[model samples]
Target chain A: MDVRSRNHVTVTGRVGGPVVMLAHGFGCDQNMWRLVVPALERDFTVVLFDHVGSGNSELSAWSPERYSSMDGYAEDVLELCRELALGPVTFVGHSVSAMMGVLAAAREPEAFAGLVLLAPSACFIDDPDTGYRGGFSAADIDELLESLDANYLGWSGAMAPVIMGNPERPELGEELTNSFCRTDPGIARVFARVTFLSDNRRDLSQVRVPTLVAQCSSDAIAPPEVGEFIHAQIPGSRLTTLNATGHCPQLAAPEETAAAIAAFARAAG
Target chain B: MTCGTGGEEGGRERDNGSGPGEEEALFSALLEDSTEDLYEHAPCGFLSTLLDGRIAKANATLLDWLGYRRSDLVGRRHFSDLLTVGGRLYYETHFGPLLRMQGEVSGVALELKAADGSRLPVMVTSKVKTGIDGQPLLIRTTVFEARDRRAYETELLRARREADQERDRLKLLNATLQTTLLPPALANVPGLDVSAYYHIASADEVGGDFYDLFPLATGTWGLFLGDVCGKGATAAAVTSLARYTLRAAAVYDPDPAAVLANLNTVLNHEYNGDDPRFCTVVFGLLTPDADRGGFHIVLASGGHPPALMMRADGTADFLPTPGGQLIGVLPDAHIATATVHLAPGDTLLLYTDGLTEARTAAGGEDRYGDDALLAFIRDLAPSTASDTIGAVRVLLGTFGTGVDDDTAVLAVHVPRAGSEERH
Candidate 1:
């Protein structure tokens, strides 16, 4: 099968404009960028795709050995870029996808023009000796994994609203919950493990592309410290803190997220 | 009473005194009594937390379950303090953020650390209470005891783990049994180089492919490669019977065709009725020719793929042995024979159909047919026995999961003198 179709790539906006690829985080599909895509589509070509085993992407394309690490996911992104003939494109990644962007850009610097990382965290588990707080400890991650395994439906119902962080619009939370439930549970468990257990602190230094670290003000997933750390590690990278609260700035505060990405893209150009 | 309209009037007055007014008084009293009492002694625990997850209010039922007094929790500790270490971590990372974002979270499983150092399993549901201005004010949480549910979940997990272990054990047993069916190593012929390989597609089930190269007597060797009709225990039975019978038969009569004829008769007699088992096999008897400095090989085929012979002069082709019927199928079966002299630097290759029948492409529509094998052999002509088998192994690895059937290959070659030393 063609790599573009396998990843379910969808293109929109100016036909020959600078490409802007948007990648969603874990537990979400490309639809998560519905709010943010409209703002970027007018000036730049917007490329959106679901990760394999999520959304409309072919589940058969998901091999355990192939996608066992973040590197494998990065390979998929590079493959998509190569197949689409996208040259030095702006890559916008949210949450776990932020690390995916980093890994891809580091491997093939010529494939990326710039990177916009939304609420990115290089590591999740807290290291006492190193004093790096990714928020949860190892045991807490285990409990979360166990909870997911025990009743993924219940976990999705409980977590989706919290992750979306727009309590005023209960419908938004409901939609996110439905999306979470729609994901295959077996794939979700493996994805969850890969997301939480990954430590890409060493990989941050290798990013050669001009990057923007857009941190949410009160994100429980990736705190301000993590964003600062990423900004410091990447050479010639900018950091912008959005007033938006929660882990998902694109969902809760799309305008600010898009404005930051646009500003970074313009500055890079 | 006497001044009224006697007995009828008196009875109506008595009913009016107790009917509506008395019932209203009693219902009001019950409502007033239960309101505060119900909140304190409700079936589930109730608590309210500030935006920062600090305990602002807690009910008596929750306090009782954790062996904590109201004074100890309220204004003194955060809601996360009551949770176990792991639960606390989960609460801080997942639950806290979710409640803030979604405004509500339900049926979250957690364990609370009791005052006496015991753990209490609970299911928590929390909702954000918004003010009139649409701002989240505080979190209202309800905790339900989940002891029974937790126990059931634990038992289920244990059963699943046990089943996985049992499957692993069965796989180990099958692997050990499979190893016993094949020869440990091919017997080293005096003047020829020999090599063999067996590829197993799956470890869970035992495949019926078998091969053996053993010395029959002084200066003669009996070799065979075959695949049984099915897999698992049934095919394993046929494979064992065929291997032993071929060796015993070849010892009695050294001719390749006569040896296969004996095997056919034995299998047809043993499994002649319903549930008859069968196999496709190639049997070879080798004798050294002193004058040519090579071996004379006579091969008999029973519905097997034709053997490929790569000659010393950079040429490779199949030695045809046609019209052979599958062993153990009928009362009498045809066993085709072919005689070939393995001159110096010539290799004879015998393999089952698994290699040819493997899917060659991702779509799985095309098989690695006989023509592809023939082309491959022609390219690899003048190859040593070890080199040919090594190349086939590498080629099979490229097939990945597409090679669904077990494959066995046996090769014997007469090495060119003084070019390479024999091991």
Candidate 2:
């Protein structure tokens, strides 16, 4: 199988420079990075690819047994890196892909130079015994899943605005909603379960790369405490709280998000 | 009252409200009394919160449901504080942001924590009140009791989960029943190495493919492999009947061709109608030849794939039994017979069409046909029975989801003279 066709990889920007790979999260595809790409493209090589069940990637490549967990997604990331011969590239992951980067970087530290996690959560369900807050309970996750299964269109309409978080710019929310609606409903249901039910807390401590956690202010999806938890677990990691509000800072506040990432990438390099 | 005597004067008096002053006083008093009563004791709970989610004002009906005083909520607690932990999380993540972005959200299911620590299921609808400049000022919310809806949804979820469990149980039952149709274990043939494997394409549905290797009489063994016309209970019935009949008939005659003839007669007699059933089977009778120090095997094929033989000296070929008709298809199905000797270190393999007809490539347009199997066996000449079966198992795994049919393989090898103990 062609790895490029498998991931629908798109590479642009300065040649022979440092490569910055952008991986989108669960609901949207690589197009979610549209606003943030131009900022880094001036100096760095920007690479973007959708996960297999999202965007223009081949739908036939989806196998339930292969993609039952995040490990399979991590394999795709590593495969993409190896195909491009990108050595020690910088990885920028949004939402669930943030954890994918963590898993990849932990397993193969030599493949990544630095990590930028945007609105990432190592776990989504709250663990009462540990007093750790993941912003959702198991029942809430169940309700969310049921809502997705019952009326996917209504769920998309109700959830896209909440995830995008900018009332002033309704177009952003509209775009996010459209992206959610465009996805295959069955794949989206499975992907949603995989995303929210996953627990990568133990993988956080294994991240050896220079990591930057960029959390937005008042983000309901990933609370401030979750960001602090990630920063604490990852040794020598920097935590920067952006002035932006909501779960998606890349779409909500691109300039600040890009500036923060660029500053970290330059320093890490 | 006195003006009623005149027609135009009485009409003017009534129109100007001079005739019924007492009745007008009662209607105005009723309207003034009900306005406040409506807000306080409405059917739904009503609340207004500050921009930061703190409670600004709550209606009397909401306070009564939660068993809280107006002072306890207003100016003291946030609206999120009244929700259960999970509901609070959902409110913060999905509800609050949606209200901010869309200005309103409706029919969101949530649970509110009451004063006594019990949970109240409610459906909430909230709207962000905006200022003159289009900036959000506060949030106005309506809460409806959803006890009936919650109970119904819970029942629905429970029923769905039970149905899933029941389906899994049925699959297990079918699998167990399918296993019973085959031999528990191939009879231990002294001085010979034997192996068999069954590849099931689906766990939910039972396939009609079956195989067995069992002893018949002194110094002779009966081995047969077949695939019934269809799957599920109907084909399974035919498969069981054919397997038992073949075993029982071999005991009476011991000739491979005669045993298959008996099965054809029984099937043709039992089913000769619109819903007729049939199968392709190959039966083999093996006997030790003391003079040659090898085994003499006679195979009878009834529209089955030819058996492959791998010689000890790195040579492989198929023992063809052509011109045979499918068993049970006719009154007297033609059974073709072929005889071969399994010398020292030689192996013979019998398999159903599942192997040759499997989709070999990723596109699934091509099959792993007879020629491909011949070539594959040629590469593995001089192989033992277990080794041949293991190699085929690995190849089948590579085919992944393309192999949409059940496969049964049986191989028997006569070990070299000195290696009988190892075999």
After the best TM-score superposition of candidate 1, give how far the Cα of residue A82 lies from its true spot, in angstroms: 5.3
Native contact recovery (fnat) for each candidate is 0.30, 0.05
Q: Stretches of candidate 1 above 4 Å error?
A: A1-10, A29-31, A49-85, A100-111, A127-132, A152-210, A228-238, B1-145, B172-180, B183-202, B213-221, B261-280, B286-423
Candidate 2, residues A1-269: lDDT per residue as tens digits? 89999888999988876889999887667777787889989988889998988877787898887777999999999999999996778899888899999999999999998999999999998999999999887777776555444333345444434434477878876765564345666787677777888999999999999999999886767999999999999999999999986677776678899899888877876
lDDT of 2 by residue, B153-218 (tens): 667767876887999998998899789988999999887899999998888778889888889888
- As a whole number from 0 to 100, the lDDT of residue B286 in candidate 2 is 89
Q: A1-269, model 1: which lDDT tens digit per residue?
A: 88887888999988887889999877668877887889998888889999887767888899888777898899999998999996778999888889999999999999999999988999987878888888877776777667655554365544555545556878865666664456666787677777888999999999999999999887656779999999999999999999886677776677888888887876764
Where's the lowest-lDDT run of ten residues in candidate 2 chain A?
A: A147-156
Q: Across the candidates, what are chain A's individual TM-scores?
A: 0.89, 0.89
Cα error, residue B145 of model 1, in Å, equals 4.8
